[model samples]
Target chain A: MAEIKLNNLTKRWGDFIGVDDQSLHIKDREFLVLLGPSGCGKTTTMRMIAGLEEPTAGEIWIGDRMVNDDLPKDRDVAMVFQNYGLYPHMTIFDNIAYPLKVRGTDKSEIRPRVEKAAEQVELTEFLHRKPKALSGGQRQRVALARAIVRTPKVFLMDEPLSNLDAKLRVTMRAELKHLSRALQITTVYVTHDQIEAMTLADRVAVMKNGIIQQLGTPDDIYNNPANLFVAGFIGSPAMNLINGSVTDGMFVTTGGTRLVPVKSPDREKAILGVRADDMHVHEAGQGDIDVTIYAFENTGESTLLTVQWGKQRVIARGDRHLRKDQDDVVGISLNQDHLYLFDPETEDRIEM
Target chain B: MRDNTLKYLLVLPAVLVVFVTAIWPLIEAARLSFTVGRLNRPGSLDQYLGWENYLWAFFEEPAFWNSVWVTAIYTLLTVGLTTVFALGLALLLAPGGRLRSSAQALLILPFAMSPALIGVSFRFMFNPEFGLFDAFFGIVFPPLADVSWLADPQLALAVVVMADVWGWIPFLTLVLIGGLASVPRDTVEAAQVDGASGWRVFKDVTLPQLAPVLAVVVILKSIFSLKTFDQVFMLTNGGPGTATQTLSHYIYFNGMKYGQIGYSASVAWLMVIPMIFLTYAYAKFVFRKADQ
Candidate 1:
């Protein structure tokens, strides 16, 4: 019942388009994530849904009604801003209860509901203290508590955990996932972090240049990216796109080395996309192509080898225990099944 | 020299300047307040009269008490009216764009005029015959059509208060605009999305955050209002049987016109008491913001 439908949504400020014409349907109780780099219109899309930013042209439907002209308050959506936005003058409890108080909820009902929301966010003890007294994480919790204090139709979160430290972000991400699940509200989360999208979202819409580049599950995007942008953006160490052309159905590197056999028709120019994890590292002369290591890094979880392959450098993930030094010769083989072929001119997938 | 001694030495000239420019005048005034300091009488400044001037103003003279009453009411009305109107104007202009910004720039023109000039301009504008505000108010209110603004005792006080409020609103509006700008935009948006109506959002979110600035504004306005002299001196000059006479006008009339310097000095010292308290309060707000 809380599903959101956006039709022909476009936000433009004069010549600069924030969000181009797009349509999306977020299923009820679904945790959909809008993932993109900064200024990619993910936050704009969420704000449009929140009725904060006016759409230059579109129809927005929350629940059964078309809310194109409705104010943010009438939209029945709660948002967690990046800055937390807690009322500094009020105590934490009052901040949480503000929505209820402003709506003229009974004085008798406000306390228990506020207390419950605070308890859910583990902020029960800090209720008496003002927001200025709390740390960054605690203030973020206060913002969360305030959002959940009311049963809104939609929850729009614009990088709620981006302010937290790395360790705290991880913890909060887990807690957020758990909270969203328990609350069972339709949630739209926006973030640049791939892991957060992968772990939390029912579906992720990867966006670029005010357009949704791809919309799919984490596994689908990781395995089958629709374009060069998606292939490059979704993975850490980014998918290595080597400039080459197809000849006799074989993808050749710019240096004229035949890299892999692709299913695409012969093209004058193409780019091969491969994740670092998919490129297997072997000892010199054992693999298909031998390259000198430009850099070797052990991240404890895995070892990364940046290898000099012809004119381009490709990062290969080696086994954690693998020991290597810079300038060491290593063999890097592309996983044939995992390879992505993109048309260099169009930057679209070649559908091999 | 040692560092401590050198620091004191460096500050010595500034302290001396303050003592000469500020402290000396105050001490001289206080000494004069205790004596029969007459402008015409030779060696009358050092003739000690003790608490006679102070007691006479407090107990005997009804003119002094009338001026005190007028000053109090004037201060209250001007401070309250100026602050409320300034806040409204600030809210209107704070969401700035080309037109509103230009309008805000134009608002400074009224405040830039000297207070005495403002008083003269307002007096001219409120004249019963062929006056701009007089005709405007007459057309709007209807009941005030035949009423002469300056000739009536209450209306003269009202005109003076109006002129003061009009002259001061622009500067205060600019300050409040700065205060409104400093309020984090996130909180206001959050309130909007929290299902609060526009009025509710202002009351609960914007107002509480704006409280400190409002406090500073009120305190500042009160101090300035209590010290008001230039406008009243030009506009009303304590006329209509001393109905519009403020403390400063009263002191001027007593000391300069009547040549009773000691009595005027005593009354001026009395006026300094409230200013000291207001100054302390203003200093507290300034220092608190610094601490934060």
Candidate 2:
């Protein structure tokens, strides 16, 4: 397995910049995920590593070789495209055997290797069938089988599960995790699905506007976001960010009401970031702040209450047993240990 | 009022038009071939010939066989050359940037010229005294300085084939470009990442997807080549001891120049046989593609 390193990689098309100058070092046998919304340059970064796209500036090193001028065939990397990119005219057996065949492997060694790879992906029975006859998930498995048929130096996957149906996506995601663990190849996966990055990545690099906002373990990023963007982007139901000012060591809402005590010097303007699960809902006037519930939603495992806090709605997760309707007064208490304060002007987190 | 009835009814006008424009002429030609239909002798039009014209052309006429041989070689040369050159041009133009797209747009200009005009231009270009190609070839090869291209039998046929190929390449290239565009881009990229080189990707992925389109191009070009007459008429006029005479030229000479309408009609009917088979094969490919 090979480690991939990007040194100040940049990609530009005329005035439009696809990827700005950024550096990343992926360790050997590590599963690094590039996670971001559309147009965030995650796929462009992976394509550069695959030698599919030429970097406008900077160096890409795979193992010890600087593959800046290498063709895709010389890169010794296998990629699974978002559309699976299966050869529609070739059978699954030939599709998987193509890399080996093109690399000048012996004929006798091809069939057994193809069979073994197909078996790994559980596609032994569909070897003779063309990709057009297979379902989306089956085609995706064929793409995976093609990549794993030959042990390449690295594996690059660009949202390989994005095209499948929701149920099949989850099943395939689990299979992918198991397969990646079994193979232990250096993999760089790109995805916009936060759950996939959280589950599949050993370390996730969250990107925005062609820059990495945060690169850390999934737990670390979720538990301790570095900035306002990461804090708002990482959690489910998104972290609620309330605008307020820190005065007399207490955070005051814009409506001139004192909320919670924070251990920070007085600032003219600050934003408080809190996750949905961090805020506890209680009976009216029983907690820190009394607010009317704007809406209540039961999501089976937990009930979520969107309450009005100083003219802004903040979602709070309560027990599944709790039932509250709109206009119902609920007491909301901020968990001080989990609260994050940020300067409104800089949009950077202020460590308390 | 039903869907099935409405669909058939909608196609009725087209069927009637085909019958009037196509089927009627074919039936009339077949009928005229059986009679001694002479343009110069009106009284002989009703005289029953009973396949004498066909038998005469098949056995007694060496000139008819000569035309057949010339037409066969011409068709083969033009179709093969046009397809090879057009496919190469399509490959070059298919990637599509500003310069390549402009070149592609310029290709249509040659196709827009009439085949008769192209033939006339080729004749002027090969003129021995003061022609562009003649002077260039004479200067490049001094042995050909005094040679008259149109005066020689073999050279005249080659010039005719070249003219036909040049005139048809632009149209065929445009069609093949459309075919190339329809091949999935991802499949080619996938082949590249699968460790195949540039040429291998084309051979394995691009060519296989382009097979159906190439078949259409070949069949269409063959039919057009077989029916070629306008260029030959304008350029050689079946001269140089009838060296560049094709089947259509032979039929025209027999019916119009010699007034042997019945004999020409029989030869024309013989030519239609090959066209029917080609049309049937083309229809099969089109329908099979639709099924997919």
Who wins the lDDT comparison?
2
* Alpha carbon lDDT at A78, candidate 2: 96
Model 1 chain A worst lDDT run, 10 consecutive residues: A343-352
Per-candidate RMSD, Å: 1.5, 1.8
- In candidate 1, what are the lDDT values of residues A175-244, reduced to their tens digit? 9999998999999999999989989999999999899999998888888999988898887889998999
Candidate 2 wrong stretches, greater than 4 Å:
B1-6
lDDT of 2 by residue, B1-292 (tens): 9999999999999999999999999998898898898999977777789999899999999999999999999999999999999999999999999999999999999999999999999999999887888899899999988889999999999999999999999999999999999898888888888899999998999999999989999999999998899999999998798999999999999999999888899999999999999999988887887888
Task: Pick the DockQ winner.
Answer: 1
Model 2 vs truth, CA RMSD: 1.8
lDDT of 2 by residue, A243-294 (tens): 9999999999898889899999999999999999999999999999899999
Top candidate on TM-score is 1
Q: How well does candidate 1 reproduce the true complex, by DockQ?
A: 0.83
Name the DockQ score for candidate 2. 0.81
Query: Residue B7 in candidate 2 has what lDDT?
Result: 100
Query: DockQ numbers for every candidate?
Result: 0.83, 0.81
